[model samples]
Target chain A: MAQVTLRKLVKMYDEVQAVRGIDLDIADKEFIVLVGPSGCGKSTTLRMIAGLEEINSGDIAIGGHIVNDVPPKDRDIAMVFQNYALYPHMNVYENMSFGLKLKRTPKDVIDGRVKQAAQILDITELLDRKPKQLSGGQRQRVAMGRAIVRDPKVFLFDEPLSNLDAKLRVQMRTEIKKVHQKVRTTTVYVTHDQVEAMTLADRVVVMNAGLIEQVGTPNELYHTPATKFVAGFIGSPAMNFLKCSLEQAAGALRVRVSDTLSFPVPADRTQRYTPHVGKANLLLGLRPEHITETRRHTEPNQHDFDMKIDVVEPMGMETLVYFSVGGVELCGRVNPNAGAAEATSMKLLADLNNMHLIDDATGKVL
Target chain B: MTDTAIRAGAAGPKYGSMSRDRRWALRWSYFFLVLFAIFFLTPPIYMFITSLKTSAEISAEINPWWVFNPTLGNYIELLTQDTFLRFFRNSAIVSILVVTITMAISVVAAFALARMKFWGSATLATGVFLTYLIPETLLFIPLFKMFAWVNETLGIQLMNNWWTMIILYPTLTVPFCTWIMIGYFASIPKELDEAALIDGATWTQTLTKIFIPVALPGIIAATIFAFTVSWAQFLYPLAFTTSTSELVLPVGIVTTLIKGDVFNWGQIMAGALLGAAPPLIIYAFLMDYYIAGLTAGATKG
Candidate 1:
């Protein structure tokens, strides 16, 4: 029953504010991933929760106890670092059993816990070997195994898979997910890769420049981003945003791209966008998949337009077609058999039902 | 001629000449290596050969490199002398005690300066390294006067005691050893300590359980440096302590083996060679760790 709650957490390093006041309530047994670009304060927030960093002014409670002033050891939390900070002098068994030994757990119980963790992490055969002797993936397992043996209230991971090669990273991502399932502890993971966050987290907290942009389940964050930053940062091949204006022409609200093209606002969104009818510098945000080639199964609200193809990237199942609208380079997915080619014109569809209208000045979705 | 034959004829002598140049280069390298070996090994070898000779053979101009009589008289006599035994014991005690004290102070100070950043930690780290640059020769004068003042005011004699070397040697060793250890501790990823802190270990426990074990090579390197500095230090003992029973090895050997205008060459050579043995054996066994410790900061930082 270890539900970690962070209230108005702030961290400052000298003059730079790394983590602004952030408040988050993590449910017990929920695996939450705090993700952002580099230097976005996700790692700082996680460290504050782990008691590794001093909270400038805040309250961090784990299992209903305020631990802002408590030391990390007394907080009963374990962290797995990105570099797998294993004691190079000790063998795997000794590394895993270190915390238990420090707590003065009896020899037999320490042995039992270490062996059990080794069995769970599937590192039984490598107990006698030192950390230097293990491979990168093996060392990562040992690091997690060390955390598992303690059975702490919370497990904080600071980009634990950033060091591995891409293939090993994906494999370890699944391994971490399995470990979380078995242990069911309140886990807070930090990573820059959104794919890892989307795949492994039960809920994802998207942070940017010392503040969280949005927090929701992966599906919710993907489908309904609260801010323009969240929409642009949460997906790969990123969301393409076009600068335009919302104007009233012919007694109807429309997204005026230029003199040549205009997309009528969907009837469902007209009421929300009616207040900002004559506003210029409006940003139209759409994911790549949402701006695909016009198809028979395309929704009724999707608007089709002609675009000049700048480049065609063939990705086997689907081809990424790059085009330009209002001087903004936009990406749209098309069937590889759609005959999309460079230096040619192609008909692409922008699904207005799923399109996002953001005010450029405030960067907030309307 | 065929094209193959023409090419083979053109390339054959050039290939032969390249190998000839390589052979000469190898020969020159080995030649210099041997020259360096003889140049460095001669003094120690001459000392050993002289230690084996009798008083007559040393003064007689028999070959300087060879021992004609080959006797253990100097070894036997020095080993039996209570004063010589006392000097040996004092040197051993001072060195071991100094190494212990130096390691303790350096390890803790280095960890603080390296890992824990306070307001002036960076400046203080640079200050520590700069202190190592202040030669012991300049400080020993003030140190000598301070000891004199202590004896006069407090009535406790810190000078002229064998244990005084233990106190004075760390002044020379701790700065450099601390700098080396600071480099080592800094090179370790900051994550290891944080992980230990989160895993139910205090800062002291982190140092003892994590930093100490992980930085074993650095600690061994610092120990070897402290031991060698204490064992072979000549200037401080010469300036501070003058008592017969209180002198360390370097000053003890030189002062005792030479009887004003009369040098005991056999005993002097034997004593110097024996005193050099401890450091030499340590170097031979742990040269790799020593070099690693010395270069760890420069390369890593």
Candidate 2:
């Protein structure tokens, strides 16, 4: 039972803080992914957990034991690098068995574990081939096999799939998820790709500027982002934000986006949003999928408005329509057959049930 | 003429000119290649020819380059002579010892400088290569004096000893070998060692098992460099060792075979050919690795 914990973890290179003070608790058997844009400290945090980087001032505990001074090998952790750092001279079997041999594990036990890992990764046929003889995907499997043969407390992957081609990357994503389901080892995977994070992680840790923006399950982060950064980062066609102000209209709060466009706050959030009525620096944050073509039957708080489409992108199953709202460009997803063409007007529905009101001044979602 | 014949005649001159240009280029390339080959190979061929000739026929001068009557007398005499055998033995021992010592010190030093960087490591790495640039011609004088001082102060003879070459040769070979190895070691991705560290291998184990094998080509190149440098070196052995029994091949053959206006041309050629054999055989076998290691150092890191 190896649950990793970090308390006030900080890393500094010269005067630059690569990782700011952060606290986290990773439960046993949990698969956590740290993801963000480049230089957001995700890779640095993973390296620190692997004991490859020194903590500037913090405590890292694995299985409830402080491992601040423990070396990487003694931490009982395995890391798969981006480049698949397999021994070029060693065959796949020897590569998998290197760690065990280093620990002086018995020959038969090492053999059994390697063969078992090769079977698990479905690389048994490649046991005799050297690393150079393997394809890129096959080499990636051998790297993972090398890590799995150790059966360590935690598996640390440092952007292990970043080197594969696009199609191979998606294929390996499912392969990784399947392996995690079978092995059930606590894993920490880092990547800048949000889709990989959402698909592979049990919970995603969204980081920005050396600080974690939010941590939650994929659906939680997508539907209810706590910060503007998280909302913008977690989706493919990112959530759109339009400059607006909340105004009190009779007993309801209306989010006024422009002279002709305004959305009434959903009834469920009226109480929470009433205090912020007439507040300046307000933004209407809504996802592209929430604003779509007017449906046959409208649900509660769904408002219909006409938008002159500025651009159109037909993406096979869905069409992305772009239009101007208060001088800010906004995107909406409609059915591909809805005929979203550039320079054309279409009646679109704005679903306020999924709308987010953000305080642009502090970048907080209210 | 027929229509096809007229078309073929019109196109022939243009196509024929291109082929003529290519043929001339090929002829000139081979011309210089053979010229350079003969220029470089003539001396060795002449040495082999002289080694096969008797001293009487060599002096007759009927045709200096040709052997009127060839004999194995020179080879047989040198092989039987205890002094010549001793010179061969001394050269072999010195070269083998220097190569071993040079590799041991340089491999570890290069690994430390390239991977396990510390304070001033970059400057020190550059400093090592700079030391190699300080030609041995300049340092040999100082080194000769140092050995002299050691002899006077300790009452132990440092001069006229073949074993002293073992200590002196590494000063020349280690710096350059370490420089070559530093390039090779630096070219290996940093993730490799980090992976090894997480795999439970200590620094020593990583160097022995992972690095040494991966850099084997560089090691072979450095070994050849060390072996060749020490085997053919002339100035240090001549300056330091004087006695007949205390000489290596280059110094031994020159000092003994050419005594006071009388030169043993046949025996000298035979000795020179035999002395050249070991390095020739090593290069012949490991030439590809030697070239790879050399170019990798320049291009990789």
Candidate 3:
């Protein structure tokens, strides 16, 4: 088990900075996932940790030992690539045992480790088959098996499941989490899929445009994102941001989204939002789950308003309803039985307790 | 029921017309195939038929295509002659050595050019292909003069030896073999070597255990090309080696089997047929791999 540490890591491709100066600390056996959209430098950071890519300026320490000039083989890290780079010529057994054989480990020990890894991956029957003979999911398992047999200090995955189909990707995501739990090795997985990051990572590091936006637990990222980007990026159906202006009311504060629609700020946030009243370039951020169909009984900080549904998508358990507020389109998830329809006004409730007020100028949550 | 019947009737004639057109097209294709096959096969067929005829039968004003008194006399004569056997041995040794040397040098050079990037590597790769374009016919004169200079300066006899062809053939074969191997090596994904690198494999191990096996088809194709070029090469062996024992198959057959204005047609045809045997057998067995190697650059192997 090892903890990984990065200090002011920076990488530049000519003039474009792929990874700017950033620092992070990962605990022992912690599965940390670096997640972002394309070209966000998540993969670059993982490659640096694997010693596949040289860092322009930084110190990467694995198990508290700095490995700046070490080559990838000496770094004691195993990587599973996006395309499942299994030795196409070697069968599953040889692919798994290749690293140990290179290090001149005893043949019996190599065989034992390979067999154990195959058993853990549930691919014992497939040991004799080549990579081409296996399915996409099986190949991915072999790629993971190759890493596990090495028993390295760290495991680096660069979007290993991206090549599989959607259903297989989800299955492999769970499979990866299970394997990580069984092995408990320090893992650094990189992906553009937030759902994969949220499901597999012990702690998710959300990156945006070459910098770390936030690093927190999955639930922490979901419930309390640190920045506007994180708040917008963490949730599916994405948190909607509506341009609004804070206003002073009789004894409370109100966020006026349009000339006709406004939400009263919760009593708990009134003191914090008092200074932002009449502020320009302010946005009210609310997740799709936070806005739902109205109920017979209302809770504190829950306010109701009417919206004309532009589209209604029924997703078995939940119905995603889309509507517009002052020219900004917003999505809300409601119960499938809520009777939502096209071009019809429906009463919806917005929970102010889960709402985030963001500064549009700075892209930060207040 | 009437509409369904009409629909079925409409589709039936279209399917029939398509099959009829395909049948006629197939017949036309076979006809041209036979025509082309006869055109290409006539020379070798004549050579085989003439090799069976005695010299008297060949001189007689009879059917040239028909072997009146067919015998294996020419084959028996050439096989018994020590000089012809020496020619065969020289040709075999030269071709085998050239293939081995060409593959060894090309595989290493291609791997370095394809995978390991450094200063001027791209230009060097292009330069290698450019060397292949310089035909040996134009360079043989300079090479001939260069060998003389080597003999005069270093006091080493670099001419009139069967092994000297081994040295000259790679200049013709290495550039092309290296080009083919570079294409094969580049087609492999970059992540494969990176995976091997992380597996604690040295660069040499990766080349031997990973690349050589993966690019075996291309290597085979290159080996065949090098062997064929060295085996059938007439000009270089003629200019470099003039003695009867030092001559390889192609040049030895013409120089020894045909005296001044007098040709031993039966023995010459038999020797030519025997010389063609090795390449023909090789191609018959490895035809698929040769085609795959040739097309690998256009599509994934």
Best model per DockQ: 3
How would you encode candidate 3's per-residue C-alpha lDDT over B131-176 as one tens digit per residue?
9999778998999899999999999897999999989999999999
lDDT tens string, model 1, A255-291?
8777898888888887889898878768888899988
Residue A146's C-alpha lDDT in candidate 1?
93
Q: Which structure is stronger by DockQ: 1 or 3?
A: 3
- Which pairs clash (backbone N, Cα, C closer than 3 Å) in model 3? none
In candidate 2, what are the lDDT values of residues A1-366, reduced to their tens digit? 999999999999999999999888999999999999999999999999999999999899999999999999999999999988888778889989999999999999999999999999999999998787788889899899999999999999999899888999999999999999999999999999999999999999999999989999999999999999999999989999999888887998898999988888898999999888888998889999999999999999999999999999999999999999878899999999887889989999999999999998899999
Regions of candidate 1 where Cα sits further than 4 Å from its true position:
A296-298, B1-29, B288-301
What is every candidate's C-alpha DockQ against the true complex, given to 2 decimals? 0.42, 0.38, 0.44
Q: Which candidate is the best by TM-score?
A: 3
lDDT tens digits, residue span B1-301, model 1: 6999989977889888988999999999999999999999998889999998888889996678877679999988888988888888999999999999999999999999999889999999999999989988899889978998999999989988989888889989999999999988988878778878877788899899888877878888888989999998999999888989998888988999999988899999888888888888988988786455322211112
lDDT of 1 at B282: 87
Pairs of residues at least 3 apart in sequence or in different chains that clash in candidate 1: none
Measured against the true structure, the TM-scores of the candidates, in listed sequence, are: 0.92, 0.92, 0.95
Give the per-residue Cα lDDT of candidate 2 at A160.
89
In Å, candidate 3's interface RMSD is 5.2
In terms of docking quality, how is candidate 3 classified? acceptable
Error of 3 at B42 (Å): 2.2
Ten-residue region with minimum lDDT total, candidate 2 chain B: B292-301
> Which parts of model 3 are misplaced by more than 4 Å?
B1-10, B287-301
